[model samples]
Target: MVFFNKVGKVALGSRLRLMTAIITDDAAKVYELYEADFMPKWFPVFYTLTEEREITITEIANEIGHSQPSVSKIVQEMITAGLVNDNLKTTDKRRNIVALTEKGLILSKKIKLQCIDVEAAVESLISESNHNLWAALEEWEFLLEQKSLFKRVNEQKKMRESQDVQIIEYTPEYQEAFKALNEEWISTYFEMEEADYKALDNPKEYILDKGGKILVALYKNEPVGVCALIKMNDENYDFEMAKMAVSPKAQGKSIGWLLGEAIVKNAKELGASKLYLESNTILKPAINLYHKLGFEKVSGLATPYKRCNIQMELIIK
Candidate 1:
């Protein structure tokens, strides 16, 4: 027997390939010993054609779970060996049909008897095992048909991540996250200015002490996003929604939208009349989200950061 030293410990795919090769080799030997006129590989196409009588190459490929090209190649070989006939359909000249010849029919009779013995041998081997490998294989195939292995794994990963995400009011513990999340994006796109650092580094002094509120998004209890609503004026209840950030890994799960919505809801509770924000035009997706959340473009707004070229405001009605 051919063997690799670590083959037994390999993954399922490698083990299945090895098993298929071993079984095909053994079946070829058995066919030779019985003096069968056909190879083991030809058995599937031959047996299917015999049962199907007259069928297209495409039909045989579908029935046997093989590519049409592969079945067509095998059919050509069978035609050359005088074991099968390939003819163009009179009604549909474009379609080619395959049928077993007299010699193939005789071989099919012999193979049918041999197949019974092979089935008994396979049953005996399975009966000796503690677990039913055949039933497990069928179950696995059914599950895979329902959804591909790749899609199932990806959906599972998304579900686990979604379960861990939670949005909450900011606390002292999230002070570093408030700074780090904002700094990460600002440093990547534009230089971090003094105003950015002041607001990020000292949220309590610059924001909370000024009657503003901050919100943080947590993934598995770890802060990944932050957004702040700064009080602009007390008389008209005006506020500036600024200093929003989400980590690179936590960007695509609508975390920013959730943070924005949470802050807007808080603004309503605080009796704010207008919510304003300063941002650059380069941030297309962020701007798009702002537009979606009822924020519209407005000119002539003073900004502390140099990156602020576009200003938007939402009238909280």
Candidate 2:
């Protein structure tokens, strides 16, 4: 036995391999002690054929969770040892079926009795363990089937980064993204008006060229939300927060909060003393977000869109 005390803990892969090697070597030694010609590596295929009577190489591979090539190699060795025979299917010459020979059947019966000893030894080892290792292994296999280990790890990574939303300034590459994101919500809630088209289609001319800024939220390097800070021509340093939209797929992931915080920061940086927005009361979530960001409800404000029934403003210090 190798001591891993210096290493402190053994890796999962190494531990599993070591356990398999130890059991295989012990089984091989038992077979040798009994003066049997069979090997431990041959048991899976030999025992399966003995019970199944006749089966194809592919079937054996599938039943035993081994590669077809590996199973085929073992079958070949069995054939060379005169323990099994292979015959081509009469209806399909391409397919070959395998069956145990007389010698194989006799050897299988002897091995069956030996397996009782192996099972007793395994049970004794399990009794010495602090916990039920077999039960733990079964539960682990079930979970792997439900969701693979790789997928579970990726989901954990996504959950951790869900709060880490990133905001980026709009560029020529994101031109289509800005338009698509805005149009998705606008077209869904209400019909797109002429003003909507002008702003969504030509953001550079209407927003950027007029000293306004557009910010896009990025999650995993993909544009998922957008908002624009439009400079108002009024004497006061006030800006209109417009065209805020988060992709439906990314709605519940806090991308909207990130975009809202970013647009406010950008507005303050651009010398704005107040930020105003025009929205519909039907948009309860958006309205709630605005309220959470300290935007106060205000009375009368002129809005070009017919959908604007609610107006709010935030004072920037």
Candidate 3:
């Protein structure tokens, strides 16, 4: 939900965003996908087949963006394989009329079914992503595509254009932005009462005294998001999990997930077996994210607190 640097220069950390795709022609599974959908359900790319008219081999190659020789070879292979018919009367007899055989039509239908399977595979990988994540990916991809294709931007040039986000130990240097974003977030979205906002700003020092790690997300030189990790030492309290809060300005752009990912990755680096989080059910989007990241439910595990209304945990390997 970032809207900060519009028409202005931004920092490095603000520029790096991640996109995920399940269907990549570059992967080995591409063959699997191809096998799934090689047959045409009205093959939009092939005009003659759709119109039941004759078209030259060159026309198909141009439509599919393949070389003429390669298209001819594939057509020849399909004819021999009985998946297509290429022998037909044309305005010119030497030129063949191309159409799918009965076998090819059946295979095309089968492929359409397998494309459904490909979609299932994609859904499984990310679990169930939120609408926000999917929508953000779509918008971001279009922006990046415009820059890469039309702007003729190179990889290194794009890197230089990206923001410089740093994930480090949280210190007093970040308290201002942290406090500012949190207060603004409460005021803007949650309509949080004065008591709730005050309580958040005045979190107990004892909680911070433990193994709390602060992660500050900066766009170029400005602070955009902040996450805190409070380690539970058995001396004070036994069970523990990570804690995070992001700014309203940075709400919908997956900054929270960025912060969450950094915290989880660090948890693995620190060798924590199970990472827990405490949040109110009122924050439905955040809760849904925990589910997407493989976190399940537990009762009464939340501690060090008064702010949380619900509890969730993730077991990290």
Name the weakest run of 10 consecutive residues (lDDT summed) in model 2. Answer: 1-10
Question: Which ranking of candidates, highest lDDT first?
Answer: 2, 1, 3
Where's the lowest-lDDT run of ten residues in candidate 3? 17-26
Query: What's the true lDDT of residue 224 in model 1?
Result: 89
Best by TM-score: 2
User: Which structure among the candidates has the greatest lDDT?
Assistant: 2
Q: Write the per-residue lDDT of candidate 1 for residues 131-206, one digit (tens) a residue.
A: 8889989999999999998887676666667667788988998898899899889998999999998898899999
TM-score of each: 0.55, 0.55, 0.43
Residue range 1-317, candidate 2, lDDT tens digits: 34554554445567778889988888888998766798789989998998898899999999999999999999999999999999944577777889999998888888888888888987898999998888899999999999997787676665677766789999978889999998899889998888888898999999999999999888889999999999897664379999999999887676777788889999888888899998999999999999988898886766789888888899998
lDDT of prediction 3: 0.61
**Clash counts for all predictions:** 0, 0, 10
As for lDDT, the candidate ahead, 1 or 3, is 1
Q: After superposition, how far is residue 291 of candidate 1 from its true place, in Å?
A: 22
Candidate 3 lDDT tens digits, 135-206:
677897788776854354344443453335555666666766666776675555455555444334644453
